[model samples]
Target: MHILVDRITEKTGLDPEKVEPAVGIMLNFIAKNSTREEVETLLEAFPAAEGFLAIDEATENKGLFGGLASKMNASVGVLAALNEMTTLGLTVEDIQKVAKETVEYTREKAGPEFTDEIVARVPGLAEIT
Candidate 1:
């Protein structure tokens, strides 16, 4: 909480004392299931000390965080795809060789969403495995 307040205060030119309690309460709330006092404290719009930490802790437990997870996976996939092409010298012409085999595999294992998601994330890799 202190670290966050210091950083935020330094950046925003606000007093660290003003935000520390709020951030601490927010963090506590995030760590717990939460209560009314915390909610009331947060409604005041004071960016609390533990806001980022609490969010990190809360989100750490949720596996199906759909948007954030998808975005993170998409970023990784895109980087990998680019790396495969650039570092491995996978050419535009090689795309043809990969296309047919991928379609066959997709047809064989149709239910898994991972295949479709990876394809979408990696752009031209849709027709590759």
Candidate 2:
């Protein structure tokens, strides 16, 4: 997980701390939308992925300018995840880079088929580029 974060940080030029939450929120969105079998396969492939999806009180507190995001009716998806990453001062291009790095890394670790299934299932995920 840290390796993924590191790669995204380096690729996107975002801070490591900022990258963590971004990764968490994105992973949370992906896991939430994935089928049970898909989620199980992803978890089996990357044990630390569950940790990335876990949102603590601290992370929840940071949502949408100190939790305003929770007040809004926003479903976790590619757009929502991009909004979260943008709040961390990332441009759309940066967000795209992060998305690319994330997908590529997951493909490497979890296999291309699993990664492709995830991207295909998540709404607007293919548009990240």
Candidate 3:
């Protein structure tokens, strides 16, 4: 849902003053959260985002600020895993195997892209001795 918002914001190229109202209207529909069930029902009727929001305490607490932050963190984790797997010369199956393992292991010092790119540069990286 936030991803869709970013795309819309970019495409419309509207300033915050204009964009915020549109955003409020959209998120309001997605959450459909109100003190009264009838209001929530009316809100859900808008048809803007009935099934998209998978909200919970953490996501709800961020109040629209945390979703993007969470996406960035997820991106970092994925890139880090890619870096480790590539440099280790993990084959497709190896990568598939290590993906679960990578979740158990994360590098705090370096991005995986750095390691993967370096491995690609080494002449013998793809071949084993």
Candidate 4:
């Protein structure tokens, strides 16, 4: 997790504290939308990943009004993660840079073949990178 946080920080100039939760949101988003094999590969490459895989339902659904009345949901998976990242004060360009750097880091850690396989399984990931 630190590795990912560091990589994101290095690539995006985001604070480590903010990067931590941003990456967690992305990992949780991926785990929700990806296949078991896809998630398992990432977990194997990044053991600390499991800690971030669970989405907090309370936080996930909370809205401006902090209740169902104002609860407008972001699109699921990477889009949702991207939306959350924006709340952390990142621009779309920063998100794209972060996404590309993340994939590059994963490729270095887990090999291109494995990383590519994982990316192929996640919807809209290609668009982001």
Number of the predicted model whose lDDT against the real structure is largest: 2
Collision pairs in model 3: 83-112
Error of 2 at 55 (Å): 4.2
Instruction: Tell me which of candidates 1 and 4 scores higher on TM-score.
Output: 4
Of the two candidates 1 and 4, the one with more favorable lDDT, higher being better, is 4
Better lDDT candidate (1, 2):
2
Each prediction's TM-score against the native? Answer: 0.26, 0.79, 0.21, 0.73
Best by TM-score: 2
- Give lDDT tens digits, candidate 4, residues 1-129: 467778778766777766666666666656666678877877898777776555333256332233332233323445556777677677788777767776777688768998787677677777887
User: How accurate locally is residue 61 in candidate 3, as Cα lDDT from 0 to 100?
Assistant: 26
Candidate 3, which segments miss by more than 4 Å at Cα?
Answer: 1-11, 14-33, 55-58, 62-129
Which ten-residue region of model 3 has the weakest summed lDDT? 100-109
Better of 1 and 3 by lDDT: 1
lDDT of 4 at 101: 72
RMSD in Å for all candidates: 20.4, 3.2, 20.2, 4.3
For candidate 2, give the lDDT of residue 108: 86
Clashing pairs in 4: none
For candidate 3, give the lDDT: 0.33
